[model samples]
Target: MKSPEHPSAGRADVRIVAASPDAARQVADALRRRFAATEQRSYPVDDSGGTRLHLTVDTTHRPEPAQPWLVSSRSSGDARTQTDEI
Candidate 1:
């Protein structure tokens, strides 16, 4: 069977910051499920507090993969930023 076209296809490089590593993994897993062709990586914060997670997903495609949703913690103190490249 053929797959459905993604809403945000043709975009690449999705970056997100979460409250914890688990949260980041959860969000990445969710995105991977949503986009069958997504490649995800997570970086957990290693410090005294241990309350931050950074994640990056690279979706491979000819033109590019769709733009994935970013997951950021509400208590992160800074607003999240998103950028797109074509």
Candidate 2:
């Protein structure tokens, strides 16, 4: 699949699914430290039973390269969305 062309293009995108917002934040922090550059966003769902966090990272300095690394590093159970250009 093609990678998104956002500023974070060649970077790695991380998504965390947690039981609570706090958990998601905690995971995001951990991921942020691991990755040099990171972007974070949150979403609200009617079903508050649990919280989910999605993070996208730009591993490469290039505007848009390949996303093989992302596909490989991504969690087996997590849902992913790849866009073509921001």
Candidate 3:
């Protein structure tokens, strides 16, 4: 969803509309991990299958970077737990 410029600095309202509930949730989850997000509200688009999720995120805030090993593990599709690395 394109965010029109907000009057306030470092904060934007975002709306995530997806064809399915799962798809909307995945986008919301990823956004939450990356930004300081408010509680999400979900709404049904119509009688058909579609979802709309609304939330505000603080653009100025950023989540910590993933650890090197964890990042590499994901890229390689290795399911080893952190303890398994020991």
Candidate 4:
């Protein structure tokens, strides 16, 4: 017997299986945010109450973070002294 071939380096075949289609789609959407991904395809699991979503992502390119929390503050004062009125 021969072994199956894998995807090329920096490319991946991602599968999101969940109890509901919404759950699977959410996971696929998250992956799309982090990598260059193809449109997701959906399939119903055989005899199971679950949905399967498949997509291909290129790991070599990752998009910028949705929220840049690591950026340093430019303020001259200490962070503890900063005040914000809500």
> Largest lDDT belongs to which candidate?
3
After superposition, the stretches of candidate 3 with alpha carbons farther than 4 Å from their true spots are 1-7, 64-86
If both were scored by lDDT, which would come out higher, candidate 2 or candidate 3?
Answer: 3
Pairs in clash, predicted candidate 3 = none
Candidate 1 lDDT score at position 36 = 46
RMSD to native for every prediction? Answer: 17.4, 19.0, 8.7, 7.8
lDDT of 4: 0.85
Better of 1 and 4 by TM-score: 4
Candidate 1 ranges beyond 4 A from true positions? 1-9, 46-86
lDDT at 28, model 4: 88
Give the per-residue lDDT of model 2 (tens digit) for 1-86.
99855544566656677888888898887655555545667775458667766777656543333468878687877555657634
> Per-residue CA lDDT of candidate 3, range 1-86, in tens?
99766637998888999999999999998998899888999999998889999989889988676688866666566666787576
Give candidate 1's error at residue 14 in angstroms: 1.0
What are the lDDT scores of the predictions, listed in order? 0.53, 0.66, 0.87, 0.85
Q: Which ten residues in a row have the lowest lDDT in candidate 1?
A: 48-57
* Per-prediction TM-score: 0.38, 0.49, 0.63, 0.65
Q: Residues 1-86, candidate 1: write the lDDT tens digits.
A: 99854445554455667767677667766766554435555555566333443333335433235454554323566555646633
Q: Candidate order by TM-score, highest to lowest?
A: 4, 3, 2, 1
Worst 10 residues of 2 by lDDT: 57-66
